[model samples]
Target: MVSDLAAAIWMYTVGPWLDHSSKFTRTGTLGGHHLLLLIIALTGFLMLAALAVLTDNFTHSTPMLAIARNVACVISVIALTGLLALILMALLSRLLFGPLRP
Candidate 1:
């Protein structure tokens, strides 16, 4: 959709600007595992959305749509779990790493 494309464009354009200005560093922060998890979770979400759109022509009561939606919902739940784990990990890192010195 146009909204997703525009948001992606905005993030691509502005993400680095925000990161640089914020002096954001991954050191003592999230590790590669966390990043990989986030990427996989996001990929799952996109695939779910694409599946829904691709199957839009099918009748709502069809078994295929039901199966697709159920699968997508399950994948979304997994993605949500991944995101929640990331948040908890980030919080733990903050507690463990302590605040940056002024």
Candidate 2:
């Protein structure tokens, strides 16, 4: 629930800010934004990996643990999907609008 909320907040807030900022900036390249998305994806992957390791280490599983695992997986997928959409949007924008110029 918390993760979902956080993702929603990020998408609604930071995502638009990036979009707006990209428009004003003269940088022709979106390398920095791409790098940011990559970093976000990496962080999500690391979190999911850590959860998996923790789940494996535990012999007995509880109901809460199962719920937590499911939530974590869902959040990770959401994050990746959002990032993919952003990347695709960026690529399409570049193709349609051409590169930003000074």
Candidate 3:
């Protein structure tokens, strides 16, 4: 938890710095919909994976912990599924439409 907190703090402090840096925008391949889909897919995968790990970790513990984790797991899975579905739809649209030009 402390590590997560530290990482969060670091990102909060450094994210804007990275964003404002001249190298940030030009660092990656600039695509219109392709870049957006990549970001969405990345977030969707990460969220689902994190929630799965948390759910697994919380299992086989105290009764309260089990109950809370179960509830949270269900909610998280539902939300993640919805988000991933949207990301999937976006990807499909981009694939069908071909890459957009700036």
Q: Give TM per candidate.
A: 0.40, 0.37, 0.36
> What are the per-model numbers of colliding residue pairs?
0, 0, 0
Backbone clash total for model 1 is 0
- Compare the candidates by lDDT and give the number of the best one: 2
Clashing pairs in 3: none
Candidate 3 TM-score over all chains jointly:
0.36
Which window of ten consecutive residues has the lowest lDDT sum in model 1?
A: 23-32
User: What tens-digit string does per-residue lDDT give for candidate 1 at 9-93?
Assistant: 4334443443344323222112223344344455555765676667773334467767876775665554445334545767888
Give candidates' CA RMSD values in order.
7.1, 9.3, 10.8
lDDT tens per residue, model 3, 1-102: 232233334334443443455442222212213233334334444544555476684444567656654554454343334334545766887999988885
Candidate 2 lDDT, tens digit per residue, 1-102?
A: 344345545544565465456553212113325345444545555665666677684455678777766666665665556545556777888999998895
Q: TM-score rank, highest first?
A: 1, 2, 3
TM-score of 1: 0.40
After TM-score superposition, what is the CA distance of residue 23 in candidate 3 from its true location, in Å?
A: 35
lDDT of 3 at 19: 41
RMSD from true fold, candidate 1: 7.1
Candidate 1: misplaced stretches above 4 Å?
A: 1-32, 57-61, 85-102
